[model samples]
Target: MDKSHNLERHLMSRKGEHNYSATVIWTGNSGEGTKHYRAFSRDHEITCGSKPTIKGSSDPAFRGDSSRYNPEELLLSSLSACHMLWYLHLCADSGITVSNYSDHAEGRMIETQNGSGHFEKVLLKPVVNIGTSDDKDLAKSLHDKAHSFCFIANSVNFDVRCEPEIVVG
Candidate 1:
């Protein structure tokens, strides 16, 4: 079977728009509720379809609860997960069997003197375990393709760098 035909078929199958939605309900109303900067909590709930609700808050440095997930963490998670999913798909297309995968992703943000901030870059350190040793190079190269195809990575303004470690197990 020709790989190009398979690639064309795969590309053809993805010709439609994909839509997603989520709801965030603010749970922060401390009695006084925004009466002062310190008067309210920074808690919230995130829900989408039938998925379980996620407890969310601002980063602890901003007076939010340490126990809850912050937006920055969620953004990193989205980028990591999107890249992993695309990598797995491309691996399957390239005849590489991925046995295990994990990523330790990190991002850097810079805050301006006026209180605005933006992520400057994100690093995705993926440890991918493949079923055979013959395709180690191919496995490592797939991370680049995955990063290119990742919707979340493509949507972000900062650089999403991939440093994938391929291991045969």
Candidate 2:
């Protein structure tokens, strides 16, 4: 099988639009913290609550504080999450099983004269740990294949890179 053909085929795949809805209500002092959000999508309603890092454990809604993950985090985290999901799907289709997938995503917001330059580019350093049954060469191929197949990655000018490691367990 020619490698370039695989890339071309992946590139030619169609892209579709996605939509989501959410709402959050703020409650006073001890009732609920300022970090509350409701996300609704495809038969799932996620009532997100932040970790105690933001709201002190002494508070009643300590777990629902938005201090743990801010808006900036959402930006980077979503990018990392989207990339990982696409990569995982590509790997599975390519007959590769991923044992673990974690990413260290970071971005810089340049305060320019115009205002603020949105996260111009983010560095998504993903460390993919694969199982022993997976072949190293094949795993590398799948990782490369996934990088090309990820829609969010291609959509953004951000540089996303994966530094994968294998651990046979």
Candidate 3:
């Protein structure tokens, strides 16, 4: 089963089903002795989480007073996850062995322009750490390819930055 004839591309869509939605259960324990909780929506009812609270209404990681994954933080995760998936696929197709993978993403939200008083301009920062037994150039190229093919990165109108530091171990 050589790789030459196995070349193929694919298409994927998320949230396609009307009843599909991920609700991260927040049990009021943030692993650091803090009470935080919230939930997402799939329909009109927003009664998933404990509602009407000054505390459990936000994400702790996003500096939210409570603890639910914020829309912005979810954006960062989506992009990072997409990049990681593509990176691994590219590596496998290129016959590269990846021993480790991790990405820490951050987004900077600024004020919206045109007299809008809300925040805007999310700058996605993805610091990727990967270990591979392939040529350094190939690894770098795979990173580049992943960045180029990441759907979430292309769907947004923000400045997405990928600082890929590859290592062979």
At residue 150, give the lDDT of candidate 1: 89
* Model 3 regions more than 4 Å off: 1-56, 59-63, 113-133
lDDT of 1 by residue, 28-114 (tens): 997998999999999999999989999999999899899999999999999999999999988888889998999999999888899
**Candidate 2: Cα lDDT at 20:** 54
Local accuracy by lDDT, each model: 0.92, 0.59, 0.60
Judged by whole-model lDDT over C-alpha atoms, candidate 2 comes out at: 0.59
User: Number of the top candidate by lDDT?
Assistant: 1
Comparing 2 with 3 on TM-score, the higher-scoring candidate is 3
Put down candidate 2 lDDT per residue, 1-169, tens digits, no spaces.
7645675577578556667544443333343433453321112123444422221111122233443344555667777788788777766666667888778877765656875555666777777777777776776666666677666677766566666554544
**Candidate 3 C-alpha lDDT tens digits along 1-169:** 6552353423332324444333444444435434332333211112324554221333444345434445556577888899889988887877877777777666776645663332244333344344544677777777778888888888777777777767776
Q: TM-score for model 1?
A: 0.95
User: Which scores higher on lDDT, 1 or 3?
Assistant: 1
Instruction: Pick the TM-score winner.
Output: 1
Model 1 clashing residue pairs (backbone): none
